[model samples]
Target chain A: MSTSERLIESTRELLWERGYVGTSPKAILERAGAGQGSMYHHFRGKPDLALAAIRRTADEMWATAEAVLDGPGTPYERITAYLRREREALRGCPVGRLTMDPDVIADDALRAPVDETLDRLREHIAQIVEEGKEQGEFAPGLDGEEIAAAVVATVQGGYVLARAAGSPTAFDAAVRGLLALLAPPTR
Target chain B: MSTSERLIESTRELLWERGYVGTSPKAILERAGAGQGSMYHHFRGKPDLALAAIRRTADEMWATAEAVLDGPGTPYERITAYLRREREALRGCPVGRLTMDPDVIADDALRAPVDETLDRLREHIAQIVEEGKEQGEFAPGLDGEEIAAAVVATVQGGYVLARAAGSPTAFDAAVRGLLALLAPPTR
Candidate 1:
């Protein structure tokens, strides 16, 4: 890859590891194997480079979620697909992880992509819930938006539980618990 | 407070603000107004200090949640009270925040309080849900554990949304949406 591409990729990895507050431009340059001039040549500074990385990570997260949500299935099936999709449970969500970084939250340019990604995902899930309700897969009075928000929260919070224990068991349990709630009453 | 007490309190604040990976020993000492020797005298190092702070934060969080959860009210009323309790929406949960730090996850001692705090909180919530079911406030088939997990996830994810947007509106919306889901249906 070119120096610019490598710089963005390295920033993404470093941001995942150290977060925006902990990561330095020097570290990014070192990780990418580029010098100061080369880094500055391609991007304005750390914030500029970070913004690029954040956007890339945001897009990647959405694409992954879409693969499950938009895949061929019934609404319940799609929701299950999204939850059961293979993930590096210990590593946590890249976009959700940024929400914890003070530096990332303090910057509008950096935080926008993170906010938009989650908002879109929640909206997409809400749409699926609405479909489920129409298809009689869920209780007639169930609130689609509320259920969608709850669903997304489960995934995000499940990561926190898993990471804290240094085990994926909590994450799996949280997911299984959610699926149990979503299952039809007769089953 | 004693020098050791002051140091632990300072570490808790800094850890909440910057997380375990982002905080430095120098920063902790400086914030506590304790010199290096004094800090070392109280604790072996940053990890030891962090464990104390995390435990303190966990205790404080549980105390706060119990105020709402253990209050005298209907099951739904108590759960709603817990959800509506005042919080610094942008700052996030102090215990939950640590789960995002790479260093905290890397060390078992540092992570124990966070894991146990969440685990206990989930159980506490599940117990409340179970009571609600027994009281005939919820559908008989509702899975108390699953609903409890979903409720906790909403709070954690709500903080992420609020912080990312630099507004509490999203957090409020998420909570409101979740409460709507938990509300009884008019048959």
Candidate 2:
């Protein structure tokens, strides 16, 4: 990869592991195996480089979600698939985790991609839910947007539980509970 | 408050705001208005003092949740009251946020209270859900444990969404969605 590409990739990993406040420019350069001059030549500064990394992370998250949401099977199946997809639970959601970083939330530019990524995820899920409601697969009174928000929250919150307990069972239990609720009404 | 009490309170605030890696011993001392000798005299070091703060936060969280959960109301009402309680969304959960801090998660002693607190919360909610199920309030097929996990995840995850969007609406949407799912069957 080019120096710029390497730098951006390294920044993404650091930001995921260390958060914005913990990650330093020096660490980024070292991890990328690039010099100070190379880093500056490629980007204005830490925030600029972080923005690039965050945008890339956001795009990747969207692409991954789209693959499942827009893929084969019914809307319910797609959502189930999305929920069951492989995740590094202990590591937490790459984009979702950034929300906890004060530095990221304090800056609009820094937070935009993160915000947009989650919003899109919720909206995408809402659209699928809408389809389900229209097809009579879900209760007519159900609100697509609301269920979508719950779905997103379950995944994000699962990470928090998993990390706290040092066990993925906490995460699995949450998903299972949500799926049970979403199961087609038997009554 | 005593020097130790002041120190612990300051540490809690710092941990909530800056996380484990970001909070420093000197900063803690400064915030508490305690001198170096006083801080050292009160605790072994940062981690030790941090444990006290984390425990306090956990206890306080339980106390607050218990008040709502143990209050006079239906199981659903109690759960709803717990959900609708006022929170500082931007600041995030005092205990839940620690899971993202590598320093805290890496230290078993530091992570214990956070893990136990959440686990206890899930169990507490599960018991309430079980009561609801037994009383024909919730669907008989519902797993109290699973629903409890979802409830906890929603709150923890709500902080994530709210922070991501820089608005509390995202959090409110998730809660509303989950509540709708838990609503008594009309059919």
Candidate 3:
């Protein structure tokens, strides 16, 4: 659409594929079908555009997780749905991948959205877990925050494993294993 | 160290920090305290040297995991020790980080060690899980392979979370959560 929108969109895709260090302003302009003048006219520089892109990606990630977590279902069902939801396993999580970028982590401004997104996801999962406990669906003594952190870690780690293996089996297997572990104990 | 040995060591460190695309021939030579001729004298080029580094990193990763998985105490204890082991959380896993490198994943030759290392780890963990099942330390019906994959994912994912937050709390919490899920239900 607009030059600004195109620049932000292009920055998001490039950042996902190449990371901050690997990405260059020239490449972003080329990808966006915009020129140097358009880029500067639209934003101050790469960092400014990148911050917008990171925030957009973070917001998108939260929205996707929020839909599943807040969707109508039992707490366990919702958690399972979120895990089983389709993903481009090899590409990895857009937000999660940013964590590996040295340039992104070194800058507080760029890193804030990344940290906030993960923290919010953990909290969202913890809320669902607490609801499960209240409904007598989960062990009352279980700590929701801890379990939520584990859920997030498993998903992130699953991406790393799947990418490492060049297949999605490890990813699927990890999800299956986590679900099993979270299954209610049979008396 | 010999020229070849120094070259390989330097390549390993560079690969860990900057990834495949970001690492350069000149950079590797400089880091190794070797000359350009010395690099070519030892290896064919960057790819050749990288393979050595990848294999070395993979072997080192396995050795570290094996020590814990094969060490003292029961299956549960071993698993817990491995999860709780000290790590440079922000730096990420040496071998695991390679998975994020587009170049490494694109080359079959480069990807072999990464795949093998992860596969062997899953199998190693699966073996322990199976033993735990047989010993009646875990639920009999749990799939050892699935649980093993989940355990591996948690560690990989833990790194992602910790790096995102610039703290180890999420990583530690994730471990605590998984262990809680894995704990045998008390009647």
Highest lDDT, which number? 2
**Distance from true location, Cα of A59 in model 1, Å:** 0.9
Off by over 4 Å in 1: A136-142, A182-187, B184-187
Show where candidate 2 strays beyond 4 Å.
none
lDDT of each: 0.85, 0.92, 0.90
Model 2 reproduced share of reference interface contacts: 0.83
Clashing pairs in 1: none
lDDT of 1: 0.85
Candidate with better lDDT, 1 vs 3: 3
lDDT of 3 by residue, B160-182 (tens): 99989999888889999999998
**Candidate 1: chain B TM-score against the reference chain B:** 0.97
The candidate, 1 or 2, that scores higher on lDDT is 2
**Best by the DockQ measure:** 2
Candidate 1 positional error at B173, Å: 2.8
Q: Distance from true position, residue B122, model 1, in Å? A: 1.6
DockQ of each: 0.54, 0.85, 0.79
Worst 10 residues of 1 chain A by lDDT: A178-187
TM-score attained by model 3: 0.96
lDDT of 1 by residue, A44-111 (tens): 89899999999999999999898889999789899999998987878888888999998888788889
